[model samples]
Target: MIQIQEPKSPWEIVHMDWVTALPPGGDRSYNACLVLVDRYSKTPMFLPCHKDDTAMDTAIMIWNKVISHTGLFQNIISDRDPKFTSALWTNLHNLFGTKLSFSTAYHPQTDGLAERMIQTLEDMIRRFCAYGLEFKDSDGFTHDWCTLIPALELAYKTSIHSSTGKTPAMLEKGWNPRLPYDTLKKDLVDIHPTASSFKIMLDKARHHANRCMQDSFKYAKERWDKSHKPPDFKIGDLVLVSTLNFNNIKGPKKLKDSFAGPFMIKALHGPNAVQLELTGELMNKHQTFTVVLIKKLQLK
Candidate 1:
């Protein structure tokens, strides 16, 4: 099993999640954790935080860090909890024209990638925090959650990923980090013969990974194409955009009610993107959204 952040673009489809739990002490009610994931590169930015992480706080925390580094994502997938659907959360996405999608209510597999990674992360944190409590600094004892999150994340990503047979670090950067293990003496290592024939083995591995990815995508697309009939929506029609926003939090991941609009179709791109014109705020928001978010209110 691999710990995967969504892997946005270089910066799109970023997934942000908050895990609530006890503070440094079981008595401290405020302790929670926040994690930001890039869907494309599988990179993670983590924060050790409190449960009072309301939607506004969540948006601010992300905006401050993510924008400083990776700018913005076109889409963000998160659960439809109060922290995500609060008006503050909606306004943030609207301000940037980013679309939000919520996970399936009862079925978490829609957001399984993030959930799995976070579960793995929490486990590691529990172990580290146990060890950290032993030390006293100067006058006081403390477990620095912020101090440890990065290292834990790094160790998790550098570890080999089973399905891809590569580390998340390597996948993101196209290179492996030189670790203490790598620096160990050759005599102390069981270095494979693949190391001796570097170029040849590297080529083989890349080819294999690429082929596997291609095959997976192909199979999924084929299955999706075969099972369902095409849903038809037309231009110049009223539609509901089923996406997650600050105040509008009710829907599943795949198909749900995200928005209600008397959207008139302006242009058709592919089998979707039924464009509409609006004078004020909503127009800019729609400009960033794709046709996949909308469904024809009246079938025609």
Candidate 2:
């Protein structure tokens, strides 16, 4: 299996994805969230947006919200969503010298950081709403989701991350933001370190975080490789593809064929994906697939 390169610095590699199809909230009627995750810190920025937002809108939003703060990222990892695949989005990043890495079809694990963060954000929202956390505006209209986002974001950033062993705020900003409880504490001292001293502390925290991340990756790879054997696929080999993600299949799923083709492997993409020589009927389908979804064809 091809190992994804770990980012060496904050905002060097970012993962972008959308959490769509939510109940409309707030004045602008936002029904979706644009999620951008920093791979190094595991810090996420959740921007409320519309589900039908186009590529241009997405680009503008990222420019204003993310790029304005972090300057520019070296790479962006995302799924093959139309907004990401569009010429506009591709060219915009290309002009800025940023590479866009698209994940293979039916594979969310390629951008797993964003996927996991979405789940966490959704769970937090559910729990908050379930607890009857609602607030009324000056006009007396009660809002649930829009009001909860800021609190959720703060809570997520302050919480210690498993892989990093430090809170995202600590890793990203070198300091934890003051919460409401901090205002009530009489013993709290407002101490601001010198710029050089603060920089040294931030560097040390990042150094520690990187080591923790490396350990986490090593442990995860060991656990995953135990159950998953990497398939040795060569060019020109005939293989059958799993139909688990195919949408064209009709009738009951259990009755349908589990595998399709005897398609010939035309090219290999790293060790985890391949390009198949597909027939005209399957022309519209994705030609590239992850190695886990393919098996060698056996003949008697």
Best by TM-score: 2
How many clashes would you count in candidate 2? Answer: 0
Tens digit of per-residue lDDT, candidate 2, span 19-87: 776677778878788777788887877788898999999888888888887779988887788888899
How well does candidate 1 score on lDDT at residue 222? 66
- Stretches off by above 4 angstroms in model 2 are 1-4, 111-133, 137-139, 184-259, 264-280, 283-285, 290-300
Whole-model lDDT per candidate: 0.54, 0.69
Taking all chains together, each candidate's TM-score versus the true structure is: 0.51, 0.68
lDDT of 1 by residue, 22-74 (tens): 34642343366676666666666666667776666766777776677777787
Q: Give per-residue lDDT, candidate 2, residue 37.
A: 76
* Clash pairs, model 2 backbone: none
